[model samples]
Target chain A: MIEVEQLSKVYGSTAAIQEVTFAVEPGEILGFLGPNGAGKTTTMRILTGYLPATSGTAKIAGFDVHENSMAVRQRIGYLPETPPLYPDMTVEGFLHFVARIKGVVAGDRAKQVENALTRCNLLEKRQVLIRKLSKGFKQRVGIAQAIVHDPPVIILDEPTVGLDPRQIIDVRNLIKSLAGDHTIILSTHILPEVSMTCSRVAIINRGRVVATNTPEQLMAELAGETGYELEVEGDIALAQARLAALPGVKTVEPIVDSVEGSGEPSRQKLRLSLVTGTDPGREIAAVVVNSGLGLYEMRRTRVSLEKVFLELTTEEKAIDPETMAAAYERASHRDTEPPILPISVTTDQTTDWAPDRTQSIKSDETPIEDETEASITAEQPSRPEEEP
Target chain B: MQSVQILFANLMAIYRRELQSYFASPFAYVIAGVFWLLSGFFFVAILLGPEGLIAQANFRDQLGMTNPPIDVAAQFVSFFLGTLSSLALFILPVLSMGLYAEERKRGTLELLATSPLTNWIVALGKLLGALTFFVTLLLPMLIYQTIALSAANPPAPFTGLLLGHLGLILLAAAVLSLGMFVSSLTDSTILAAILTFALVLFLWVVDLVGNSLVGPVGAGLKHISLIRNYTNFAQGVFDSSSLVVFLSYVMLGLFLTAQSIEAFRFQRS
Candidate 1:
């Protein structure tokens, strides 16, 4: 129940956010994904009525955020990047105070505060002073304050930052639990948080939304390639030739760094780039064994959401507005069902992959960074599938 | 009717929170203890010491040189209130310095700003909370003054005596309001306190500079001088204009604080 149209906030000369547009349906958790300083906080601040937009408009629950700020504010709960808390106050006291300010009825404030304490798992610590609590508990208190009034729309900015891994998972589960009855817009720089929690992901870079789609659709459409890297103990050239001859095996090339220049080493690494929607792992293994090559190791490699985020945010000139609109138009044309929302920006580089450019670029200089390649390949097994 | 009731409820919520913070912190108690010690010293030295007003009046009575009917009680009330006003100049800044600056530093201003409560309500609530604490600070001194004044040969006139104390409260309300405005301008409480002290000090003595000149400009400066209006108040002149000036200062401070907070929403940081 939020609509932002061409919202732009300019500070002196530099625009913090430019023509940023998006929408969230009722009960939908929209992940506002972006890197640091990518205007995620700026956009959220504008939506929360904390900062006024220079141009355009934002409406929450049908009330204009700028003109009808009080009404809009009454309908939404906001957790700033740094949770606004009074350290001297006890947890229950702070929530009671917040519930009052948020206009909850005096009769219901106690029950609402207790409800929030229970939901955030902060009941035991309600009597403790906020200053004495650890960081994770303080974060829970922050979340508790936001939800104490139980407003329909919640805007959380980086709710999981600075928490330990276990705390992050707990906070994510808490946010997920909040999604069915409350519409949530959670902004975070963490890739997996969005994938694990949000139903729809909007990738923003340089104060612009480059893509907005379901997390699965985003991964499947923009994920670079599904391929395999094999380390063989015999006849690397013969293994490459036999693998290349197989159908749907797009290309098989020897990994240069794994080769011994002076002599035929006992082991070599071979990389195979397969066409999309092709799984020839069994055929390739049989081909290697029948070709008198011993396959020591074969690892599946695909672009993870981290790579998709990097490709969206870090690529300096990959997406301009016109190309984004053209790409969105092309995507709409290719798919029969309309996009979930009015997607103003999206990428279509996947549908127009250039094979000649792949041939020109060597394996070592491939677009994927070495660290990302290793991490994605290592994490291939325990990939989080929708987090239940 | 319902809107006003809601407004009052919101205002009291903020006021209670502010008062609770003041009472819970050792720093406010430390300030109160120092105030009690200093004001107690002044009270004893001015009224009971060897070279004090009561001692001088006694010496005059023994000499039997009846120059005029000197009302020692009226003189003491006026003199003590003048001293208290100057004493308040220092303590009120410390009280008001953290009113908004602390909120800004801790990021709680975002909560207050984003909440449905109006800016003026928050300002007024905070001002009332601080003013209440300042009154509690004065209560012990007020108790001793009342006991001392009760023993006067002819009971001190309650009108002038109460008027002088009213002047003290108004002067405080004025100073605290302005200090709250200054606090909203910066996140540094120390800077807010120092600047507020500077501004109050300038307004306290503007009549001195006003006396050096001649014309409407001089009259205007002298008219707005806080010490002048406070003296009128302490002397029980019943000047409605002085009341307007003190009230105008309070309203001006509140108005400016509200405007500053409204402008803060558009500020870059």
Candidate 2:
């Protein structure tokens, strides 16, 4: 129902989005997945005819967005990030006003407004002024206004940003039900929303589409190697050697096991992770049994959609050590130093928290790279910061 | 014909919404109340105070001097219309400041820009909405005129009163349209109000600058001066050129406002 090609928007010298290309089939929901400042809203704005692209073209129902904007707008419904509401207007009044401007026929206006109110579960609050409603209800009213005219395409920007978990689920289900009648392009930074709600996911980073596929396809394509975690009571060195000696085994690493409080000395478990190109669960189990090691448990792990998203979005150019050191210095100076405790008093607590802290820091570095790279590129033209 | 009908439908939709929003807020009531109070005070004090125009005319009659008729109706209506014109310089900016500025601040401009309605329709709707409310504010002043004229020996000329009001409405339409243009340029209503007041005040006094200049330059400045054109109408004279000038100002303001909104839409896109 929507086609966008080579869509570029440049404000002065800085490009808000460059050469963005995507399509949504009729009755399909496409999740525009990206972190903040990833140009998702810019693309949606262009597609909905809310903005004009500096170059390239967008079409809805075969009408060019720029040249035939009225026709394109007639076919599309847009809910901007802020919901575009008048606080003094009641929910029903606001919907009626939107319907009139959206060109719903006068005879059907009441029916259409009622339908929207019911769809958004806003019937009870139809008479209440929008300013008196809670945030979640206001968001529902926003969605109601967009859908009141029954447009064929709906563009929503971060439809569930501030909602509680239950409200999020309710909104997700509402969006799911909207499919098959309306083509949806929803942009959000939240990862699982895409996995759960979208028929297809497009991952954008640095104003570029890095990956586009179904959630399952993305996970499968990135899940090239399999891993297994095993808990066993044995001579650690012998088990490591045997696991590494297996044909498909790539690497073997022992994990720090918290088996201190176990009563049985024979059950002093050692946890190990085995990375292999193929399943090594069976081979490792046989090896552990034949080698006289106690095998307590084994499980296989596959790549998740979150990992695929991270890998695609975090493929940043390596930073030089000087810049890294400067960044670290800036960070440490900004954060207060921990109080100096006696060596013995701090040793055990430090050891317990050190691994988790390092792991978290390592995880945080990827997104920070994406953010800094985006900001540096955006600021290169020395323009005022434009919110996406 | 079909396109025109669609355009009218769109315009009415926007016009109704804007008009409804005005009544929905307390700002409109406060503005109207202050306007009525001030205009009512000027009307009563200038024409009916203890040392007023009628009282001085009575004193002249008591002195046994045969002075020709003072034309009390003409004098009072002229002065009353002038007061309204000057008051509009301040009242209009307050009324028109929120026409587009508040919509921009609240993000509703996005909805309007992306909708199927043309920029001209939106601008015209808002202008008409503000103009209609301004007319309502002028209604109570007519009651004051009725009471004052009933007590006078020679009543006001009904044609002159109607003609003067027509001039007031035209002048107001011109000023409100320009104020709407200024409102479209900013997101802050206060800034819109201040800028509009400055622009209107400049045009209101531009004839003074014209007085110092000589020859055709002075004539041209006098011709374009808003107050100069309005003064002819205040005197119950229907000069065709003055009508043309006020109409041109209204059209110019409307055209500029439409263009401003279109430019803003492009910049956002």
Candidate 3:
């Protein structure tokens, strides 16, 4: 129902989206997944004929979006990020107005509006003014207006951003029911929303499509990169050595035991994580038991979609030396300003395992202040150390 | 035929919605009320004040110089319409400020642009809707004129009265069309209103600049001054040139507004 080919949009010098290509089958719901400012909305706007791409073309229902915008718009329904609602209008009034503008015949307008209201579960609130509706109902009204004319394609931008959990589920089920009749492309930053609601997922970042596949296929591809977590009471070194000796085992790393005050000196509890190409649970279990170690827990930790998402999005590579030096200089210059908070307070507030240099740097600054009253003393020497 | 029908349907849909929106808020009511109060004050003061035209006519008769037979009705209508034209300078901007600016601010312009309806349909619907409300605001003042004219021994010339009102309508249509164009240029309604006022004030006083100039430039400025064309109509003179001028201004404003909206669509694209 929708085909986008090498779509590129450049605003002045910055590319809002570049070479974005995706397709939605006649009955499929394609999840446009991306973080904020990742060009998802920009791509949707182009597809819906609300914006013109600087290069490339998009076809909807076999009509070019730019060349035949009116025809394309007639076949598509769009719910912009803010719902594009008139607060003074009642839900029914607004839907009827949209239906008319969308070119629904006068005879079918009322019936189509009623169908949309019922489908979105807005029949009860049809008579209520939209401004009086809650955020969730307002979102439902937005969806209702989109479907009022029964268009073949529906494009929604973050349709569930402000809804409650129950409303989200309701909306998800509503979108699910829309399949087989209407093709959908919904953009969202929520991972589970895509996993649960979309048939195929396209992950975009920095104006580029990085990955596109079914959720299951994406998970399966990353399955080999997953590791396992094991809890055992044994000689930690022997278990580590034995687990490393397994054929498929990549490496064995022992995790700290988090149990409090068990007071069993002879029995050392260790968590062993094994990075393997495949599930090595059976071989590792047999080895641990035969080696005379207590095997309290053994389970395969499957990789989740969240982990896959993070892996695909957050893998930063090497930077060139010139750019690296420029970044370092910028960081060092940023360090001269007085800290927004006291140094001791910031050091105490460290939630991560990184070192605290607040005290040592303060000690270093004390000598400089004493040596020369004319010298510009740094307010906190520790601040520079905090720069990466 | 079918395409024309669809276009009409779309225009009607937008027009109805816009008209309903105007009455749905207190903004329209406040504007109408202020307009009626100010226009009512001018109407009464012109007819009944001690120094008004009626009082001056009576004083002239007592002095035995009423041989030419002063036409109080004609003088009253002309002066009344003159006051209305001035009042339109202030009232029309308030009527038109929200036409496009409010839609842009509230983000509903996205819906309209992405719909199958064209930009001209949207702009015309809004213009007609505002014009209808302006007419409604003028309706009550018409009642005051009817009462005052009926009490006179000799009734006012109905043709002159009709011509005067037709002139007022044309002048108002011209002003509102320009104001609507200004509204389309910005999303800030206050900025639209203030900018429109400045532009209208400039045109209102363009004749002064024309008076200062010595040649064709002065003639051109005088021809374009909005008040110059309006004065002929207010005097019950059916000047085709003035009518053409007023129509030209209206068309110019409408054309610019449509282009402004089209430009906005291009910018968004």
Top TM-score prediction, candidate number: 1
Question: Residue A108 in candidate 1 has what lDDT?
Answer: 97
The per-prediction tally of clashing pairs is 0, 0, 0
RMSD in order of candidates: 8.3, 11.7, 13.2
Off by over 4 Å in 2: A222-277, A280-388, B150-152
lDDT by residue for model 3 (A1-388), tens? 8999999999878998988888889989999876666799999989987788999989999999999999999999999999899988999999999999999998999899999999999989999989899999999999998899999999999988878667887998899899889999999865556767789988776687766787655544544444444556778788889888887776666544434314655454333334534556678778888888876544343222222243222212322334323322332232234311111111111111111111111111222232222112212232221111
What 10-residue stretch in candidate 2 chain A is worst by lDDT?
Answer: A341-350
Residue B181 of model 3 has an lDDT of 93
What fraction of correct interface contacts does each candidate retain?
0.67, 0.78, 0.77
lDDT measured at residue B30 in model 2 versus the true structure, 0 to 100: 94
* Candidate 3 C-alpha lDDT tens digits along B49-159: 988988999899889996888899888988999999999999988888888899889889889988998887887888888888888888888878877877777867667
DockQ of each: 0.61, 0.62, 0.56
Candidate 1 per-residue lDDT, tens place, A1-388, comes to 9999999988998888888889999999999977666689999988888899999899999999989998988888888988899988999999999999899989999999999999999999999989899999988988998899999999998998778767877898899999989999999865556767899988776677766888776655444355666778777777878898998788776666543223447887766767767778889888988887776767664423333343333232443444334433344443334334322212222323211112111123222342244333433343321111
Q: List the per-model TM-score of the A chain.
A: 0.66, 0.65, 0.66
Question: How well is each residue in A1-388 modelled by candidate 2, as lDDT tens digits?
Answer: 8888888888788788878888999999999876566688888888877778899988899999999989988888899999999998899999999998898989999999999999999999999999899999999998988899999999999998778667877888899899999999999765456767888887765466656787555544435434455667768788888878987776666544443324545554333333423565668778888889877656443222222233223222423334333322222232233311110111011111111111101122233344344334323432212111
TM-score of each: 0.81, 0.79, 0.80
Candidate 3, Cα interface RMSD = 1.5
- iRMSD per prediction, in order: 1.0, 1.5, 1.5
Displacement of residue B56 (Cα, Å) in model 1 is: 0.6
Model 2's CAPRI class is medium
Docking class of 1: medium
Could you say which candidate leads in lDDT?
1
